[model samples]
Target: MKIAVYGASGYQGKLVLTELARRDIETVLAGRNRARLEEAASAIGLPDAERRSADASDHEALVSAFRGCDAVINCAGPFTSSGEAVVRAAIAAGCHYVDTSGEQLYVKKIFDTFTTEAENAGVTVVPAANDGCVPVDLMAHILADRLEPVEEIITTHVVVGGGGMSRGSLRSVVETIDAIKAGGLAYTDGDWHPGVPARRTAITLPGQSEATPVMAFPVPEVVTIPRHIRVRRVQGLTEAALGDRLNTPLTPEIIESLPEGPDGDGRRTQHFTYVLDATGIDGRRARGIVQGPDTYGTTAVIAVEGARRLIAEPAKPGVLAPAQAYPSTAFLDFLVPHGIQWIIEDAPAT
Candidate 1:
C-alpha cells in the first residue's frame, strides 16, 4: 500500500522512508521544502518517489499531498505546535494517520480533539507512535491481563549508547519543556494529575543487578496506556542523570546548533530497554521488559508498522492507543525479527 511521509526532509522522516523502502512499500515524500525532500529521496535511492512540499499552514496542500495514500507517517515535531494541521489534513484526505510524537500533552490533545472527527471520517489516528510509547503501551496491556484486577501500572525505560539527539528531537525537547519539567501528566483514580511527585525513586533495569535511581520522565504511556487497560495509576520513569540533563533550559538556538541526526553507525550502536511494572488489586504483580536497538530506528519501525496495520488489518476507526488498535502479543511478535525481545512474568509485589 502507498503511504505519505510528512516531514520527509527531517531525521525521523528520512528513517521512516528508509524502513518503508526496506518493506518495498511505495511512498510519497512530503514537507515544506521540495528540494530537501528530493535530496532525502535521492540519498535513499528513491529519486522517483513522488515529492509533495506543503507547509503545515496550508491545509489544502497537505490534504492533496496525502490524498490517494493509504496512510501517512508524520515525523514532524515539536508536534505540540506543528502536528494538528497534518492530522487534520490526513483525516480530511481520508488517510489514516500515525505520528512519532512523544509529547504527553499532544497525545492528550489528539485524543480529546480528534476522536470524534476521526470516528466520523472513518480514519484512524495513533499519536506517540514511537519506540517509547508503542512498546511500553503494548507491554502494559500484556502485563495487565496477567496481573488481572490491576490497579496500578508503572512504566520505566533506560537507553544506552545513543549517538546524539537530532536537531528536531532537541527542539521537541524545548517545545515540550512544560511536560518534561513537570515529569509528565499522570493518570490516577480515574483522573489525570499534574506535577506528581516521583512515586518510586528507583527501578532495576533488565540485565542489571542494582536498581538505577530515577526521576519522573515524560512518557506518553501515562496518557495512552489507560485508554484500553483497566488501571487506576500510570507514570513514567528514567534515570536521574537524564532527568537532570533535560531539566536544563533548551532553546531554539541550542537545538539549531546540533547535528541534523545520528548517522547509521550512531544509530546502530544504540540500544534500549522498556520495562512495565504492574500491580494488581489482589497484590499479585507482573513485569514486562522490551529490549531493543536504536531509539530513533526503532521508533521509525514502530510508526511504519502501526500505519501498515492501520491500513491493512484496520482497527475500529478513531484515535487509539497502540495496544487498543491491535493485538499486543501479535505486535510484540512482529518486533522479534527487528531485534526486539520481550516477555512478561510474575513478579513479587514487594
Candidate 2:
C-alpha cells in the first residue's frame, strides 16, 4: 500500500522512512523543501520513493499531496501550528492519518474538532502515535481493564541516552510552554481540570537500586487515557533533568536561538523505561513497566506499525488514540522484536 509522510526531511520523518523501508511499503516523501526531501530520500536508500513538495500552510497543496495514498504519517511536530492543517488535508483527501504529535493541546483540538468530520469521511485520525504517550496509554488500558473501577493512574518515565535535542523537539517544548500559559490542564475525578505546577518525586527504576528524581509533567496521556478508561485521575512524570528543562520559560526569540536540530552520537544506544501505577477504588494497585529503544526510533516504529494496521484493515472511522486504535497486547507485542518489551506485576489487595 502507498503512504505519504509529511515533513519527510525532518528527523522523525527520516526515521519513519527507514521503518517503512524495512517493512517494504511504498511511501511518498513530502515536505516544504524539495531539496531536503530529495536528499533525505537518497540518504535513506529510498531513492525510488515518490517525492512531493507540500507546505503545511497550504491546505490545497497538502490535500493534493495526500490524495490517492492509503495513509499519511505526519512527522511534523509542535502540532499546535501545523497539525490541524495536515489533518484537514488528510480528511479532505480521504486517507487515514497518523502523527507523532505529543502535544496535549493538539490532541484535544483534534478530538474536539475533527472526530465527527473524520467519522463522516470514513477516515481514522490517530494522534500521539509515539512513545510519548502510546506506551503509557496502552499500559493504562491493560492495567485498568484487568481491574474495573480504577481510581487513579500515574505514569513516570526516564530517558537514558546520549542524543541531544533536535530542532523539532526544541520547537515542541516552546509550543508546549505557550499552550500551558494559555491554560493549565489535567485530569481530575474523571474530568478535565486546572493543572497544578509539577513537583519532583524520587522513585527507583526497576532492577536499579539508586533512586532517580522525577517530576509530574504534562503529556498526551492526560487527554487520551480518559477516553477509554473510567479513571478518576491521570498524570505523567518525566526524569527530573528533562522536567526542569521543560519547565524553564522560553521566549520565541530564545527558542530560535537554541540548537536548530538534534545530533545523535552514532555509537550511543538510547532507551527508556515507563512505569505505570494504577489504583483501584477498593485500595488495590497494579504496576506495569515498558522498555523500548530511543524515543525517536520507537516513535517511528509506532507510526509505521500503526499505518500498516490501518492499511491492512481499516480501523473504525473517527479520531482515535494509539491504545484505542489497535489491540493493546497484540500491538505492544508486535514491537517486541524492534526493542519494545513490557511486564506487569500485580499485587493482592491489602
Candidate 3:
C-alpha cells in the first residue's frame, strides 16, 4: 500500500517517513519545502519516494497530493488550523487518514464534523494517534474493564528530551494556553467546565531518585476519553524530567517561558515516561506506564504503526482514536521492539 505523509520535512514527519521505509512501505512525501522533503527522503534512503509540494492549509493542494494514495498520515500542526482541510482532502480522495493532532478543540471538531462524512466515505480517520490519546485511551479502556463505574482518569507525561518544540507544536501550545486564559472549557466534575493551568506540584515516581515538578495542565486526551469511557474527571500533567535537583519546581511562568527555538543545539537523546491512572466507583484503581525516547520519534512510531495496520488490514470505516481503531495490546506490542516499555500496576488500596 502506498501512503502519503503530509508535512514530510519536519522532525515528526521525517521519523514517520523513516518508519514507513523501515517497513518496506512505499511513501509519497508531501510538504511545502521541496528541498527539505528531498533531503528527508534521501536520508531515509528512499530517494525515489514521490515528493509533492503542498500547503497543508490548501484543500485543493492537499487533495492533489493525496490522490491515488491508499492512506495519508498528517504530521502538520497546529492541527486546529489545518486538520479539517486534510481530513476533507482524505475523504475526497477516498483515502484512510491518521494524524498526530493533540489539540482538544480540533479533535472535537473532527468528531462533530467528520464522523458521518468519514463513515459515508468508507474510510477511517484517526486523530491524536500519538501518545497523547492512544496510550491513555487504551489505559482507560483497560481500567474500565477491570472496574465497574469508573469515575475519573488522569494521564501525567514526564518528557525529558526533545526539549525544543517544533514550530507547529509551539504554536499549538500558545493557542491552547491562550484559550485557557480566555476561559476555555475543560473536562471537570464530570463535565466540560471552564478551567486554567492552576499550579505546579512535586511528584515522585518509582525508580526515580527525587520528586519532579510537573505542570498540571489540560491535554486533549482528558477531553476525548470521557466521551468513550464512563469517566467524570480527566486531567493531564506535563512535566520536565528531573535530574540531580530534588523538588525542582516548574512554575506556570517557567512553562510559559520555554524557548521557541531552532532546536538542534539541545540534547537530542531525551527520554519520556507517562503514567495513566484511573479510579472506579468501588474504589478499584488501575495504572499503565509507557516510557520511550525522543517525543517526535515516538509520535512518528505511533502514526506509522497506525497507518501500517490501517493499510494492511483495513479497520472499520469511521473516525476513531487510536485505541478505538486498534486493539490496545497490538498497539502496545508494536512499540515494544522499538525500545518502549509498557507496565501495568495496581496501587495498594488505602
For residues 187-298, write the lDDT of model 3, one tens digit per residue.
6666766554433366566488998676555566766677667776676766543222223444446645765333434524657777877778777787888887666767
Off by over 4 Å in 2: 178-184, 197-200, 208-213, 247-268, 348-350
User: Each model's TM-score, in the order given?
Assistant: 0.97, 0.91, 0.84
Per-residue lDDT over 303-329 for candidate 1, one digit per residue giving the tens place of the 0 to 100 score: 999999999999999999999897999
lDDT of each: 0.88, 0.82, 0.75
Ranking of all candidate structures by their lDDT, best first? 1, 2, 3
Clashing pairs in 3: 161-270
Q: What are the clash counts of all predictions, listed in order? A: 0, 2, 1
Winning candidate number (lDDT): 1
TM for candidate 1 is: 0.97
Ten contiguous residues minimizing lDDT sum, candidate 3: 240-249
Error of 2 at 167 (Å): 1.6
